[model samples]
Target chain A: MANLTTKLGRLQMKNPVMTASGTFGYGTEYSDFMDLSRIGGIIVKGTTLRERQGNQYPRMAETASGMLNAVGLQNKGVNYFIEHIYPTIKDLDTNVIVNVSGSEIDDYVKTAEIINELDKIPGIELNISCPNVKEGGMAFGVSCAAAAKVVSAVRKVYDKELIVKLSPNVTDIAEIAKAVEDAGADSISLINTLLGMAINSKTRKPMLSTITGGLSGPAVKPIALRMVWQVTHAVKVPVVGLGGIMNATDAIEFMLAGATAIQVGTANFIDPAISEKIVEGINDYLDTNNFSSVTEIIGALEI
Target chain B: MKKFILDLQITHKVQLNKQNVLLKLTSKDLLPEILPGQFAEIRVDKSPTTFLRRPISINFVDIAQNELWLLVQIVGEGTKRMAEMNPGDLLNAIIPLGNTFTIPTDKNAKVVLIGGGVGVAPLYMFGEKLNRMGYKCVFLLGARSQSDLLLLNEFEKIGEVYTTTEDGSHGEKGYVTQHSLLYNPDFNYIYTCGPTPMMKAVASYAAKNEIFCEVSLENMMGCGIGACLCCVTDTTEGNLCVCTEGPVFNINKLKWQI
Candidate 1:
């Protein structure tokens, strides 16, 4: 009950726990088991200007404690989201962060421009980090100039809060995280997925059609934690950290590492209700320990 | 529907015929939402070494008692452990996922159900539902050996059943296509789910004959939904998430990667 209520930049969340995009599919599919309004926010699947057909067979491959995917940014497109999915999710009490992806700068700006016209949607999480597609994805997020260019273009057209989702596939996350910060991003979300692959071994053929894909789950946790710590210090803006966050303990570790908020990604693949369970777990930890608000715990770890 | 890490208590595990095991599960409120062909991701922790969840197709559901059946073939570590499960042991299953076979609008016409390998699981359920609804149904099931044939008596109860095995071990020798050739089969629609090669063969035969056919696909899935984009199939429209766009697809609409 204490500091559980928090702010990820200008966008306020009832709690820091939110569903990562592509995991909680526009927030209505899991309503059978989870109540939508209870959690902090929902980042719907990655959106594009045109509906993406995605990749070929075996687009996903399972790894040690994680999975690799090359889904190729498949969604109903921005226009479809505004018509079909938005009316269903926008009015819900939780924050609806529209995660927009694009193959070009104009595509992102156009997607953001359409989203800005929506009434109840609070912010836009620019997904420059998707690794599966043939187009922009990591190609944009990995370069300093490219990162700044995309962010700058969207910032000009969209006045809403901008959260730049950073890709772990990059060489120096801190440098690129700072580039987006200078480009006028309101917050940073670190460590989408570490690029990796798994092979069938017997057939001697590649496990995924893409041959390589985005790696997520607990296998990427440690590296993600380090990146969150690195980027948080490099940028002045708040950071939203996500990668293999299974429990409240894992989420708190990210918060201590300087993430103003956090998103639970691959964990939902195993358990649909994990976000609510994590929200409850964090609340219990704060209540029993006499901590007031979750925001106070953000970066509370002393050196 | 609510997806749960359901602890399905295996009530009876038996080698029903051969190379085939029938599991009777006592799960609460699971059958109400579960349909045929849609699978459950099972965490077979018979031991930690094979800890990853295994995907298994649902055979049938007895809604009245909430009893579920799975026709499992020993393929890998996950399934071998599943075959060894006892009456009270629980297995974690994420059920009613992907999608189900499309039901035809014409309840007045005859329907044919085709299945291959353990793909028979869903066709059996589909036949059961359509049979109860007053539609005429013929179920064709094929396997490699007589030992591979499963649930013959069960299918007999639902509708007219036909069987075929590769080496002449059962009712009709050769393939399910032999059964298809014999009957005027004058069917209004056909529904199928099986191994890739088998479905392709059946779809090809159906296509040549100009009979309506729909097939359920099996793919390696990370997330059972569209997110991971792992379960994909090449089509005329391009590529699609088999889990969401379909684990069930109209045969004519699908551009099978032959």
Candidate 2:
């Protein structure tokens, strides 16, 4: 049987089916519809030091087959996550990965150190690709030097498996991916929301409070796939791909493009249970192909 | 997660005039407890232009038959496609979403119901529960024109019904507030769902009269529940999510746009 299990450094996943950060809010939100235990792991909502109120009205706008968001990490901070979100989710059957976002290097290190102290947290996903904020957002992930700096800084205190999420809004994503890889990142996730905009013709103003927002959903799948392929070849670290993946076919497409795992975003806005569907679809695809596990299919595509 | 295709069979489709379609649906299993002012995010797949799910207020819920009803208008591609659905076609729907109308109490009694446009549908469900419990009910309705009036007869069958239309084409010949304020009777608690303007008007009137009123807000939502934070209502308690904190809110608890 083709074994489906994969590892990010020391941690092992039953399957390579994971939920992306920002899109999957702490995993418990979707528990009402499906069992949380079935998913491989969940990279929960982004967190910071203080409570984040996020951007204003029209946080999301629809494009052809995709949507844009400027929800500037609106969440109760790390302390609140420890007290509120973690207690409930930590007991759940799945791996709980915290998606950490920050303005400074300490914010990143402190967040990672706090999660390391927690009992059930599996990993820390550093989000250096948020274009909506004014400072230290995607700037870190876009520049290889900054990416390596943040990666090394957080790596010093993280203690556990550290995944550096790469920003697609960059001149060369593969360079930053390699930088994080060299900085001791266990894995790399690609293509956070792309910077995009919308306009209200009558008012002649931008639709979102911020003139620009991050784009996600099915529209960016092709671009995200391209990045995943590029970064997968550039770095030895495992790659988790996301950006508008709505179904199992989309997930498979990423796997073919060199991503070892896949994350479901935007689709959560449309169908809350799509991840389960994607999981089922993957299992079905594996079973029918007579492949013993998902590992055989990971980067199985022939050039 | 049980990934069963929710075979949402359309039991009945009534085209209300030309603007709206009332789609009555039934499924295999019993639905969860759905309250007034709460909505269902329906996957509007009837046409290509309307692929995203349309968030429709829960107009009515028939618990006995495991069926639900939605009063949707042709505001966009979603509602327009929903209008064309027929019997036997399945429309994937997620129900009992968002916060529902806060019924008077843990122990119920006097309750007043209010409606405007398709918003009136949810009131019917609350009215049904109230009437069965023998709570004294008063209904205040608002509409653009007499013809635009929906479910008035159904509401009248449950309680005393009052109405107002902008063109003087119906009962009160004015806004619902005009009539509600004029005959401002003692309501132990009130429930309302309607256009934002109408609900705001009702909420303010209720606030001024010192009446305990719960108004359901309508916001453009991607998910009927609280993942997107798409549907939010600013309150005295900061930015409270309309999807969770309420699609329904107490008039006193709300911070109006004014």
Candidate 3:
């Protein structure tokens, strides 16, 4: 078998198939469908300093080959995660990463500090790109200055690998990636979700309660690949790519586009056992192409 | 209950009406134990416009035939594609999802199952289970017209069926709540599933009469599991996922205005 080990700064993955945040719950949710250890990493739901009730009833809308969600980081705060959720996931064999979000800088720093104490968690993916929340989600991510400020504040208290997740809603994602890297981000993961909306012609109303939400699925693949390529060339830090990664081919496309690692998002909703299949698919591709290691394809784009 | 993602081959397809189709599916292995109010997320393949799996309620399970039935309504692209499937087509589905309805302990307790449109699907399975358990079942089904009413013969085999159609072509000339049988509903328990407004009216009537009631909610969902917190209902406890916490919930737990 071809070697599938992947490295992003201090964080090492057995393979490059990580589940995007908000899609995969705590690793326990999918324990019945597939082996959780088969995944490279599991980024738990976005946790905040305070509990959030999230948006109203209709928070989801299905579009052509994609879906929109305005589930504004509905979580029970980080403390509940440490007390209730941590113990269950701490013993999982794969890398367990927490995706942290906040309304203010202090909230991000405090949540990161608390998670930093957890022995099992290898890193934190700072989510500055959640489009659903009203306060500091995509607000901080759209601006390079705000993105750097939040990353730098969390860097002071967080000692582990700090992976800043970049939002695609901005004009120049590469500039934001560079700013976060300069502010002490160990790695950068990109193309969180593109902001989009869906409308019902008959009802003459928006499909989602929030009118607009973050779009993820196969529809956003091309945009994610373009952003990953641009940011990888502009920044020095390793990049984790995602957005409509449904299979191993999609995962390899991200690698060829210069993403050091890749994540699978909306496809998880369609097929629960997708990540494991993707891991196998990647291995099959490596063996067929006679590549010795999975890392050989990173930034191997001919053009 | 344990959930399974199985490739079930369609054994039979019956077009109940222009808007509805009854698909009977079976696997090589014995079908898993499924409760009355639970649902299945069926994957719609080859449909370009459909992205997510469609969540359809379990209409019935014929144990002797080792089959599971799904009564689908052609409301959108996903379901329209489901209606077009042939007998030999393989449909992948995640089965036994969500919570089940409460089965009363007292066999003599007066129970009423109310449904409207394709909302009557799950209640058919529920009524059958209640009848097999030695409880007399009363079903109050509603539709836009006589033709829109589905599974009348099947429901009649298991319970005393009453219906209402807007066009006065069925039993009553008005909505299910307007049926004369509800004038003095001496029911001990009521279970309903239909349009939101219809279910709300049922909840209101049940609350006023101090009858224990439960209603099934059909909310837009992302993932049928607890992961995608998309299909949430405002309840007394907080925003709970309708997929995991319930497709069925007690009226008292709901935050309905009634």
Instruction: Name the candidate that leads on lDDT.
Output: 3
* Weakest 10 consecutive residues of candidate 2 chain A by summed lDDT: A1-10
Clashes of 3: 0
Greater-TM-score candidate between 2 and 3? 3
Cα lDDT tens digits for candidate 3, B1-258: 888899999999999999999999999999999999999998999454898999999999999999999999999989999999999999999998999999997999999999999999999999999999999999999999999999999999999999999999989999999999899979999999999999999999999999999999999889999999999999998899999999999999999897
**TM-score of each model, in listed order:** 0.92, 0.93, 0.99
The residue-by-residue lDDT of candidate 2 on A1-303, one tens digit each, is 346577756567877778888777778778777777877889988888777777766676666677767777878889999998888888887778998888887888888888889979878889999888777778888888888999899899888878888889888888888889999899998889889998978889987888998888777888999999898989898899898788888898888888888889878867888888888888888888898878777788789
Which tens-of-lDDT digit does each residue in A74-94 have in candidate 1? Answer: 777888888888988878889
Query: For each model in turn, which proportion of the native inter-chain contacts is also found?
Result: 0.46, 0.18, 0.85
> Model 3 over residues A281-300: C-alpha lDDT tens digits?
99999999999899999999
DockQ of each: 0.47, 0.34, 0.87
Tell me each candidate's i-RMS in Å.
3.0, 3.5, 0.7
As for DockQ, the candidate ahead, 1 or 3, is 3
Q: TM-score order of candidates, best first? A: 3, 2, 1
Docking class of 3: high
lDDT of 1 at A156: 96
Q: Order of candidates by DockQ, top first?
A: 3, 1, 2
Model 1 docking tier (incorrect/acceptable/medium/high)? acceptable
Give the DockQ (C-alpha) for candidate 2.
0.34
